[model samples]
Target chain A: MSQIVCDSSSIISLSENCLLNLLPRFKVDFVVPRSVEKELVDKPLRVDEFEFKALRLREAINEGIIQVKDVPGVHKRAEQILAEANSLFTPRIKILHEGEAECMAMLELTDVNTLLVDERTTRLIIEDIIALGNFIQSRASFKLRMDREKAMALQERFSDVTVLRSTELIAVAYEKGLLNNLGDGHLLHASLYALKYSGCAITKGEIKEYLQLLK
Target chain B: MKKEFVEKLKKAFLHGDARGLKEISNESAEQAVLSRDKEMVLISLVSYALYKMLTKPHYHYAPGWSDFVKEVVSHLELCIKDPRAIQEALGKRLIEDIAKMDKLHGRFMGDLIERARVKQASRAYAMGLSLDSAAELTGADRFRLYAYIGRTRIHEEIPARSVRDRYERAKEVLG
Candidate 1:
């Protein structure tokens, strides 16, 4: 019953795929942290290609399709979560970034129920700690399960934060008839595959399965 | 020893002239299409493609591409001095490129980079490298590599597994 809170990755995914315009039609207000907005709109502007995408994101904001808000007290919590999350995986190698924590902070301070993210590490961090623990244990390189107390704290602190990729967002929008004009009768398939080729990390077989469900 | 020829080839690539290399390869294609000369020709083509990739002004500073170009240029320098150094040099360059590709390309550049990977992979396959080897070099996702690898000149077979099969494999290992 809460609004959709997204990170830079989801927006970047959609923007890279030329699907940013379709975002407004998702029928829910989209909120990103100020840091995430900086990532979306500023840091990438140095590159010619991303500068164009950043402009589109700026337009989405100016058009009122997206909202950028700074969540209070979220940074502290997010930093804590990031430390715990990184420790769960390979040490000395950071697995999540500040913007992910910002998204979580938004979730914590606001009523957002879902996090729209695209990166695997951040998604794994927020998915299910127990599953992640089992995964690390099964690997020879990672012999220890994540520290129990920290893992439990993370599990409890952000357990309500569900994550969805841009792929699912498009799928849901297609199902909801939000992307009806995207193409012909095969628009759904076309759109799904377009997302894949544009770096959604979705598989063709998975797209087929979802297409079946859409029908 | 073809040192000067290899150096010129390296220059043509680092200088970002695809057409120049293409014309050069076309000339050599017939002369060495089947002889020991083919090895040099294949190496030249690979260098051409890699040059077109790393020298493109658009994504010049990307971490992944930058790392690749750095490794490649060092290898190319070695390769020019000793044309016999192609396999070890370029092979190492390719593996580093794959490992660094998460920094691969910024958003708008995905399409361009993917195109470069496919073109690069085509040359690698024609040179008789395996899919894994090509993937390591091109820095393309294995899934995308598998999808683009059909009809490659390499002709080596890979498992025709579904995405579910990959997922099952993941579960088997992680469980």
Candidate 2:
């Protein structure tokens, strides 16, 4: 069975939309780092607003639908990635957080080449550093200094990692006929938008195109 | 925060200058984007709440309005005196106080703060933080943030590979 490393963003999105069942249906191992489990289950469990969602995720983990894995050297690797990625722009804003860095580290140290993340920043950092840098500079009021070499190095490290969002996962499920019972005509369309509103980083244009292709 | 900025913020609070507070909030948000300082982000958020409290007629006439404003002003005075030690706590306390006010009065105050958070989170996303990261920093709901973000051109500004290609790639990998 193949394994895909999960991040907190995707898990939270999936959980919020009641899509955690899709994990076991995939027949692939869905693993999260320890830190991600804290974000998904531990921390949220304490807050009243998110307590129910946290319980759902915790139940999924308890039932063995989602596995929690701790890989060696992940912390050290995460720190290194944080240092390099954080320093990529002058005036050094912390673009990546500890949870994201841990996810990247888990992807690097393990054999899992596929990363299931819903956030655009990590996906952009891996897939297109130049574009990410340009986007950052465009958003900032002050002129930003880009460290090209650092961006290049980080990109090279994550070059082979395949990034996918919760939206795609739901789309894949739709294509596989798992969503047939949810209503046929508008199921795919509604599901895609549901994921988008639930924190998947897919664009409206992208959803429109998906409807054209998949419908 | 610089002493000058704190002083200005205090002056805005003292004078009930909603417009000035809004401007400070914008300036602080920009600084947060550049510096990635959580304190700056908090300042932006608190300033925005203050702006709303001052400008919104409902909040002004609400019960305990005077006490709340006076308390916030006192907090600002402390912030001016020792920003490093007091700013983050003041920001958090303001949010908590607003929550309490909402409970005591009605849901109106809570709605205002939620809107403020969503607005600030949108600004953060526009200023280049990922949707999730921005939401994390601002305590905004990701669902609401994405909904707000979808209506803007931020997605267009940073185009990604086509969804079809990415979908095909996802199919290949997951299969």
Candidate 3:
């Protein structure tokens, strides 16, 4: 019964795969900032799979499956950054700038056990903060047990007892037809990236080779 | 590389001349799409111009088209003679333009800056907008924030530096 407070990236990624359906199975009460909700739902939906997720996210909110928590003081900070940012750089970076801050804040406020984010810089900053020995109990990405479970479920032959690598898991996902036309590859890629940062011995070559067969 | 080319770009951008832009666009796209050197320099130049244009409307609008063009042409000419001059000029221009925009926009701008500043100062604040703005303004890599939290668990093992240094003789190790 872990209370999972997800950043926009996790929600967007999960929803895109229509994997928000998986939340109830985990029985994790998920919280997202109102800013994240607005970001996903406020704008007109685009033609991409991302837009599909946005609509689904809105539906999840309506059903009360996912709770929205808006961080106060975020708006004021966003406004300040936007004004200066536009005067300095392109607006394309605007959402990301705020999303990163919001993600960190949400983790702090919820005291959540784990954080789920895909951005490299955000991941790096979290690692830096952790290196400073500030908070005592927080994790990022999938827990080792969770990764093992996912790998097991992904393939019968993956041998759950053996330490199957991310590349092997990806290959299994490919063989099982789970990666076909699915946007979740990005999630897999994010996980792999995080694993690499964590010093996993998994080679990307195997993953790429497996990915070639996915389509 | 040519004085005329620089003059043309200066005139086009200062005037917001769609036609002059059309010409510049065609040439650059050709260079970008076909050039052997990959036209990295030209890409940088175009990026500089676009960055300036999007960020500083007031400055672009201030001198009217012609005077701005003359100023830009002179700047480019200086840059051609000494490349470092362009880097310095670009930095100077950006700071000046940003400062002026900040001054002219006043409270409207003030509010945004304040918002971004608050997010920077407080770990509790979590607005996507504010964080995005702060990162852009501060030029800090935003992703580092996530990694910071993930790595900060107090109970975790001493980091790679100490552990690795004990095993490897030559690796760089932090105390």
User: Which candidate comes out best when scored by lDDT?
Assistant: 2
Q: Cα deviation of B110 in candidate 3 (Å)? A: 34
Candidate 1, residues A1-215: lDDT per residue as tens digits? 13678876567667766687766665567788887778677765665545776788898888876788776788897787667665654332233557776787778788776777644445555655565455444432323445767777776877766567677777666766777766557877877666555544455566787667667
Candidate 2 residue A155 C-alpha distance from true site, Å: 0.7
Model 2, residue A1: C-alpha shift (Å): 0.9
- What i-RMS does every model get? 13.9, 2.4, 17.4
Looking at model 1 chain B, which ten-residue stretch has the lowest summed lDDT?
Answer: B152-161
Q: Give the best candidate by TM-score.
A: 2
Better of 1 and 3 by TM-score: 1
Model 1: CA > 4 A from native: A90-92, A133-145, B1-175
Scored against the native two-chain complex, candidate 2 gets a DockQ of 0.50
Clashing pairs in model 2? Answer: none
lDDT of 2 by residue, B1-175 (tens): 5556667877998898989999988888778767667777777887887787777677779989989877777777777778774555566677788767766665453365777778888887777776656777777865456657655656556666788878898888777
On lDDT, the stronger of 1 and 2 is 2
TM-scores for chain B, listed for all candidates: 0.46, 0.79, 0.32
Residue range A6-123, candidate 2, lDDT tens digits: 8877887788778888888885789998988887778767766668877888999999888999999999999999898888998887687778889899989989988998877888
DockQ-wise, the better of 1 and 3 is 3
**CA lDDT of each candidate?**
0.57, 0.80, 0.40
Model 2 C-alpha RMSD vs. true structure (Å) is 2.7
